[model samples]
Target: MGKCSIKEAYVRIENGQVYVCNMNITPYEKGNIFNKDPLRPKRLLLHKSEINKLAAQTAQQGYTVVPLQVYLNGSLIKMEIGLARGKKLYDKRQDIAKKDQRREAEKEFKVRNLY
Candidate 1:
């Protein structure tokens, strides 16, 4: 079975520590037995320079740091963070309409080719 999707995802920074909240990972079958639980959120210990950079970026008005993706890179875990601002309601609606148009176009294309 596939892993369940996370409902609420966010990034939290406190006292120079970064954590990816509400993220879940499957436990490896042949992994170490004494390893911490994979389901629990782990603190990402970034370099001092990286921490300072993220802090500075998030300190600006209307900008917040968000974790876009988290995955295992080789034997180490990695997270991709982005600086993002909240979207307006109209912008969200436009995005939804674009998605619907693209989906409809794909459906039409599939039907045309299925003949």
Candidate 2:
């Protein structure tokens, strides 16, 4: 299914190809018996040059390919990925705090608008 949670996914290079793993794609409601594993690895279709570039970049120490987003272009679906370094505990905590602040601000904005 097109609707999926790619937050837990990471990229892997195998046999000169790119694969995204740990993504959870929701199963189609009506296709109950035919549903595939939601957590299966999915391959990314890219040009040879692009794959080579990604492979080279990810070969660096502590660098990994991260899936940023998924979107549609006309009838074809595309995934956006980038090379990223692992985040430290402090950085993760800061990000969580920022997200919480944004959420609280959004809540306040909605409450003020309800007058």
Off by over 4 Å in 1: 1-8, 27-39, 96-115
Per-residue CA lDDT of model 1 for 1-115, tens digit only, reads 2353344656777898987777666666677887566557668888989988988988887787777766667887667778889888899999999999999999999999999
The CA lDDT at 5 in model 1 is: 35
- Candidate 2 residues lying further than 4 Å off, grouped into runs, are 88-115
* True-structure lDDT of candidate 2: 0.91
Model 2: how far is 94 from its true place, Å? 7.4
Best by lDDT: 2
Model 1 per-residue lDDT at 23: 68
Clashing pairs in 2: none
- TM-score for each predicted model, relative to the true structure: 0.60, 0.74
